[model samples]
Target: MLATPRPRSTFSNAQIAAYFYSPCRNQYDEPVPEYFRCRCWKIRKQTSRNGFTNLMQHVRSEHPTFQEEMLAATTAQTSSVAH
Candidate 1:
């Protein structure tokens, strides 16, 4: 039997890292970080968390503008590649 294919991520690691800074790093960029800084909170410190589910939920709720921009960029890149 054929193995099931995993769905590709809508957000790339570089894009995600640029928008949300990750704490953990290594020799190479292949390994994803364990935590990401939140863009919200106008205080002395920012929030951080592990896993994409939390990060995605935070983006969907707190950063609609960023989300829209990412979507637009992704769409443009895909269209350009198709042509």
Candidate 2:
């Protein structure tokens, strides 16, 4: 079987920083890599959680423009693969 290439991040660092981060810091004063928090305006800033679920939900609910961007990108990839 052929190995599929790994995908890169679709959004830029600035775009990513606008919505999410891992707030907890270690002894070295660096953010922990495993945990993440959603920083959407519509919802209260919550406890930093794990995974993309919270971030995606924030995008879908609080940020329509971004959600559309994500859908468009995914749709393009899907159509390309189907051809």
Candidate 3:
């Protein structure tokens, strides 16, 4: 018997860290630390400057098929919730 594929939403430690520590520009044009930003915030800035391309590369190299599986699972969950 074949094993069933699992739904994927798991993100890497680096990606998770980046989500919280990245800066957000405020209405006055001053950058505000995100609510969860900590000492690692500077590292996130240096790493994420290239944006999605950089992220996708990280995902591809580290997580392989996880990115595609995550997208599919998110889409499925969103559609189901909408209905």
Candidate 4:
């Protein structure tokens, strides 16, 4: 008997990460570290291992607009909920 084709999944098919980051696979198409070729500064900086310290620093130092907007939004949200 001939094999039948399988149906594609309807759920968990969306990947938001695919938009922000580039392909991080190795020679064998395997997953790599989270901080690979990270553009945390003017030039891409590669970390020895996976961590969020660099990313946090990048947001705090590189994106002043983001910082101000985030602070304002956070203050508004918190003050609304405050007693």
Q: Write the per-residue lDDT of candidate 3 for residues 1-83, one digit (tens) a residue.
A: 98988454455445433432445566996775422333223222323444444444444455555545444554343233321
**1-83 in candidate 1: lDDT tens per residue?**
99988456466534553554445435785544454455463111223444355566565556656545656665454333421
Higher-scoring candidate on TM-score, 2 or 3: 2
lDDT by residue (3-82, candidate 4, tens digit) is 87744322111111121124356789886655333233233333547344454445445654542343355434323332
> What lDDT score belongs to each candidate, Candidate 1 first?
0.49, 0.48, 0.44, 0.37
In model 4, the worst 10-residue window by lDDT is 11-20
State each candidate's clash count: 0, 0, 0, 0
Higher-ranked by lDDT: 1 or 4: 1
Better of 2 and 4 by TM-score: 2
Can you give the TM-score per candidate against the true fold? 0.36, 0.31, 0.29, 0.30
Score residue 8 of candidate 1 by CA lDDT: 61
Expressed as tens digits, the lDDT of each residue in 1-83 for candidate 2 is 99987345556433443434445556998976544455443332333463355555565456656534544654343233321
Off by over 4 Å in 3: 1-49, 76-83
User: Against the hidden true structure, what lDDT does model 4 obtain?
Assistant: 0.37
User: lDDT value for candidate 3?
Assistant: 0.44
Off by over 4 Å in 2: 1-28, 37-50, 67-83
The C-alpha stretches of model 1 lying farther than 4 A from their native spots are 1-14, 24-33, 41-50, 71-83
